[model samples]
Target: MKTTFKKLAMPAVATASALALVACGAPADDTATDETMADETSVAQEPGTIVAVAQGNDDFSTLVTAVTAAELGETLSGEGPFTVFAPTNAAFEKLPEGTLETLTAPEGKEQLTSILTYHVVEGAIDAATLTNAIESNDGSYEIATVNGGSLTATIQDGNVVLTDAAGGTSTVTATDVAASNGMIHVIDTVLMPG
Candidate 1:
């Protein structure tokens, strides 16, 4: 395990290694108070995790709220080095009227989690890598999300575009927003996994 992480840069590797223990199911229930799990919570307070980054950035306020509502903070912040196609605040605003409200409601957590996970892919896949994959796959690439759904990536007018499961399209407005445990690519529109 140690040998595998030798490739990551300084801060990210340290964060990933420490959080990974808790992420891999270190049992944090009241009956089994694992030290690692407690440490994970404290570790999340630092600025390396994706959740921390999102919380610190005003542009991702909506995304942060959705993540919290879905109860995916620990997973996204700890069990990763993930590639998250993060929707910006403006992107969340592009949702249908009342859509965000409905999704954030407690009853909508499962569906919201599914939708959010559909935007995440394992590993730190940067834009250049995505572009290469698209080119290698003959101008498009079918990338599977953390959820069972998939996203199709294609280039449009010199920009990377993602086609969601519902056939709605979103352009990648920004690429490679680095987080300690992942990379965040900001998208202008929310991709639904309908």
Candidate 2:
């Protein structure tokens, strides 16, 4: 029995050593297979699954301001498959100087929520799916926003563009940030709810 055990252990140790060598980039017969497996696992994992990207990003200052003003920090941080059209700081800066200040005022909470929710879609929509929907609709698609109003979607230059009821258009700058509960798409301009 002892000799049998020793023989089994010898092969096991050799196999482990061979695996370690392969992991360290040593030439192996199945290196390609290993790499493929690694890629698959990594790709399956989602990146930036938190609202931290919205908070930490300097370019999203306007969005951050609105979120803070609306007291939606906790809600957005909650489990959500929320697609946010996050306007850049530069986008907000385009507004009148007092516009942001007024929006963030204490009495403007309701209005702030309306504005922020207008930018949010309930589902994760990638640029491709949005484009397909628009094309199938004869160059236009409608998305019901969290604010209870529908926004128009159009395909432009191979990108999905959203137009608010106020005649403002926002282009999707980033897409498909997957989270545990949902996905987020970053936009370049604020979307106003009608």
Candidate 3:
């Protein structure tokens, strides 16, 4: 998994740069303009773009590592409407010492995948929708993840808090980075998978 990070990051960056370059190379004619517009439209249409942006952030080192370890870098980077509750590196550091290292080990790949998948829902759910769902549900909202587990969302101290299958909790610190495929909500703590 440690090696996986370096391997995956490079390709991800190259792909993004290539996409950017292609987006920038359009000619100034009406047809080219329309094509450029369509390109932008497609890029904006992807919901997982936010995950790419989040992955590029240094604050998300642990999240990146987990993604690599779980072998989910490609999946999250793919086109889809996914709502991710991303935790910062500091959140991972708060875990017991050696926990992170263990999770990245070969034997722990399954667990790592489960934990990371717990943070993702199948569709783009914005903050407003999450808030309204919680409010309408009397402080509890249920979300089904792509991993087949369920997460329980609720409002605590005016913040959206998500409970994982393992009973671990993560509070949404930042919300709503719109991508063509989904939305991202930054969390202060990593929610461990049950």
Candidate 4:
């Protein structure tokens, strides 16, 4: 079946216009404003799946290559509604010397796939939802990943941070990059599951 994709941009409020405000109605509170902003930011992109969305973004090139190499492109493209904490190319660069190269090699596909899957949670979790989850869980929440490991979500310095199984922490650099199937939260560091 053919797919349709959407492009989303955060801080979608480029400028304030009286007409826009009058048409949409004003938000009730600070929380309401944030929720409204999040809703407005979810714009549509090209017609495809989450995999295509990641491929289209230059920042995620390394992630795309890794996913393809790991033979997970199709699965990510499937009807997921997944929450993908995609690490940037710079994040991959943060790895130790030879780490990325070794992981991308044919023999390292299994390990690479495991690590990549660790970044994914099997649902559509946007910033507001995640914040709510954290609040409900009393400041931090543990999430089981597709790779069968778990990650901890917490608020630090007023931003959402994810702690992986190996204890490395990655801050959510960008949130709510909406796709056809799910959402992408950009991270500066790759989460290690082992």
Best candidate, lDDT-wise? Answer: 1
Task: Flag clash pairs in model 4.
Answer: 6-44, 6-45, 7-43, 7-44, 7-45
> How would the candidate models be sorted by lDDT, starting from the highest?
1, 4, 3, 2
Q: What is candidate 3's lDDT per residue for 82-147, written digit by digit as tens?
A: 778888898998889998999999998988888788788776677777788778777787777767
- Segments of candidate 2 deviating more than 4 angstroms: 1-50
Error of 2 at 152 (Å): 0.4
Instruction: Score candidate 3 by lDDT.
Output: 0.71
Q: Write the number of the candidate with greater lDDT, choosing between 1 and 2.
A: 1
What would the TM-scores of all predictions be? 0.76, 0.71, 0.73, 0.76
Put down candidate 4 lDDT per residue, 1-194, tens digits, no spaces.
Answer: 11111232333221221112223444566566666676654432122466876776778899999998899999999987787999999999999999988999999999999999999888777788787878777888887788888889899998999998888999998877766677778899999997
Q: Please identify which of the two predictions, 1 or 4, would achieve the higher lDDT against the true structure.
A: 1
**Candidate 4 at residue 55, lDDT?**
77
- Model 4: runs farther than 4 Å from truth? 1-47
What range of 10 consecutive residues in model 4 has the weakest lDDT sum? 13-22
Report the Cα lDDT for candidate 1. 0.79
Where is model 3 more than 4 Å wrong at Cα?
Answer: 1-48
The per-prediction CA RMSD against the true structure, in angstroms, equals 10.5, 16.7, 9.5, 11.7
Q: lDDT for every model?
A: 0.79, 0.65, 0.71, 0.77
